[model samples]
Structure formats: C-alpha cells, structure tokens
Target: MKASRVASARSWLRTSNVPSDEYLEGIYYVQGRDFVDAGIVSSEIKKNLKEKGIPESIIRKVAVVTFEAEVNIISYAEQGTIQYYVEPGSITIEAKDIGIGIEDIELAQQEGYSTADDSIREMGFGAGMGLANIRKYSDEFEITSVPKEGTYLRSTIYVNGK
Candidate 1:
C-alpha cells in the first residue's frame, strides 16, 4: 500500500462503520446479476494498485484479470469475494465463490471455450476469453474447483515487471 492510500485507509477505518479486519484483509464482495458490478470491483483494485505506484503496465494487466475473475463469479457463482494483498515485489489476487464450479480447468483455459449462456453472451462477454485473458495477464495462475462446491482462482503478478 502507498503512503497516501494507507493514510486514507486509516481515515476511512476511523469514519466508516465497516470492520477494520476486512479493510486490512482487502476483501471485496461481488454480487451476480444480469450485469454484475465487475467494473466497479476492478476499478477499486486498480485504484489501490495505482496508489501503490505500481507500473501502469502491471496495473493494466491486473485490471483486466480482476475484471475477468469478477465476471466469472458473477456469471457462475451465487456469490463471491475478491481478496488481494500487496507485498514488496508482487501483488496476489484470490477469488473464491460458492456456486457451480468448472468441470474442466484445462478446457476452460482454452481460448474461445466458454460455458456462458445466451444471455451472458449477449452482454458481449462469455466469448471464452475470460480465463485465457486472465492467464495471459498473470505471471502465475492457479485454479481449483469441485463439482458442486465452488471455484477458487489465485493469480500473482510481479510488481517489478518481472
């Protein structure tokens, strides 16, 4: 976290009624709907990364990956949360949801392979590019899912542009 953001966050913590732990943990909730709040979620992450003085290239990649991951939860899960932490040389993003999980991780990562339905497809998304795009932008990626339990995705991008 940057000095400005840290100071702002501390001010928010003092004024806001939300828990301090959640703020410290950097968790953001997501709600799936006809059109989920994917942009809002992504922008928040971008704002934090920018405040930290992360490179623009890295910020852009993180924004894209974050949006895709959020949309996946919105399209497939009942609810989910995106958790992120900034370390000295890297930032980690973890998305967890409770909904129908992917049956095949490998297949899902294939470009142009999507399980999105017609409605979601109509929204200009679900082109089978979400996972592939995410992977393209992430330096490291990991996904885990079960039949009915849910899915979890973790991605890490190096801050030093490594």
Candidate 2:
C-alpha cells in the first residue's frame, strides 16, 4: 500500500497497532454498505504479507479469508474491523462487526445459505459462500454472535501446513 493511501485509510478507518509478540499487525475499520471500499483491507494485507516474503500459498489463504470477512462486513454490518497478526508459525485474522447478528450460525455456515438482500445478490456477491469459504481456508476457525448485537470471527492459518 502507498504511504498516502495508508495515511488516508487510517484517517477514516481509525486503524491502530497494539504492541505484541507478533511480527506484524494491522487493524482496518470497515464501513458498512461501502461496496467501493470493500476490498481495501484484504489488498493491504496481501501486500504486507508479500513484502514479508510469506509463501504465496499461505498468502492466498489469508487473502481469501480476509476478503470474505471484509465482504460480509460490508454486506451486513453497521460497521466492522478486520485485525490481523502475523506470527512465526501462523497468521491470525479476526473480524468483528456491529450489526443484526446471525440468528443461526450453524445454518449460516452451511453452503448456499444466505440472508443477503436483493442488492447484494445483484452485486454478484452473497453467494452464501463467504462463511463456508473462510472456514475452508483456515486451519482453525471460530465464530460467535448475539442475535441483536454483533458477530465476531477468528481464523488462523498455519504457516507450515497443519
């Protein structure tokens, strides 16, 4: 990502870094319903991982998971954030969103199940594959949500195949 772009993103995105053992970390805030900005977080992440010399295979997994999470946030939430940490053995990504949370996570996890509206489908998204794809690409995955509150998702991809 360019310095100017990162600076601009930080302005509206309210990004922050918290010191930790991880080699790299970034938090990108997502504005709900902003389809134009939907993939920024994932693009930045993929760039960062590439610069760090992370293997392409692993990077691909991270990209897929991050993009899916980002899309879901844009499609469903009032607002959300995607936080990523790169560790020696694995990369972890967490997406938390404030919205009408999933009522049935189990059902949502099933392929071809979606609550997306007509507009989302019109955009050629909301194929009901987001959650399923995220889980498929991660070595470890967990999700939790309260019906009227929000949703939180965490996924970890092992650097050295699990």
Candidate 3:
C-alpha cells in the first residue's frame, strides 16, 4: 500500500506543469501517514524558490508555511495536493485534501491545539502549531473545511511584504 501510494505521488509530480519563464506553478501530491514524504515536498519547493532568486527572507517564510501545510496533510488527511504559484509580486500556495476534516476551524487555529494521534506525536511533529504558523508567515491566508469531507488552505506571501 505504501509503495503504491508513493508511486501515485511520483506519477503526479511527473505530470505536473513545467515551470515557465513568466511564472512557476506546480502541484505535489501527498499521501497521508507518509511522514518522510512531507519533508521531501517542502525541500523541493524551497529549492525551487531559491533557484528563482527569491529573497532569502521570503523563501524562509514560504518554506515554513509549506512545511506546516505538508505536515498537516500527512498527519490527518488520507490524500492531498499542494499547488504553488509564483507570480510577479507574490507566491500563492494552496493545499487541498480528502480526509477527516476539522470539526472546528476556530479551535484548530489555536496554537497548541492538535488532533494528532500517538503516531504523529511519536514522529516529533503535531505540536498543534501548523495552522497558526502558516497564518503567521503568510501575508494572506484562508482555510475552509467540511467535517468528514476535506480541507482547503490557501496562503499568499507578497514579494514586497504587502
């Protein structure tokens, strides 16, 4: 099952949009309960931003947001995809997942509030700061979830700190 999930993720990555001169846009598929894969996707995004000459400070913010989002997907969702767009003045990241969605968005946004299982905690993650951190590092953020259905998170970081 794990192998098949990884294969599906790899296949999605391969078929995603190729970076263009005007802007960079791509989607990374993530499989739930896959602890290691989250970091891989986060690092790839960081590398891409660095290669594009994005300022270190902005890159750092994006990295944190991406990592937090990835961790959330891995820890809770059954499956998800992170889509990123680097445009003229901003970088936008959208994560959508099919999973046991949050029951309370308000409560979930609080720092130190987590629904992680023992396995997630054992992995040294799920300290309940993912959503809060993601919102903190983003210039704009929005999240919506349907219980037992899924969640959608969108975050944007402006290049000029807008």
Winning model by lDDT: 2
Each prediction's whole-model lDDT (CA): 0.76, 0.87, 0.86
**Candidate 2 steric clashes:** 0
Candidate 3, residues 16-117: lDDT per residue as tens digits?
Answer: 545676788778888888875666677888888887788999989888988888889889999998888989889999999999999999999999998889
User: Residue 94: error of model 2 in Å?
Assistant: 0.3
Task: Count the clashes in each prediction.
Answer: 0, 0, 0
Candidate 1 regions exceeding 4 Å error are: 1-25, 34-36
lDDT of 2 by residue, 21-108 (tens): 4588888888777776667889988887887788999999999999999999889988889999898899999999999899999999
User: Over the stretch 1-162, how does candidate 1's per-residue lDDT look in tens digits?
Assistant: 345544443333211122332232367777654253446678877877666566899789888988899888878987778877767677788999999899999999999998888767766789999999988889999999996889999999887876
Cα shift from native, residue 45, model 2 (Å): 0.7
Worst 10 residues of 2 by lDDT: 13-22
Superposed Cα RMSD, model 3: 1.8
In angstroms, the error of model 2 at 65 is 0.3
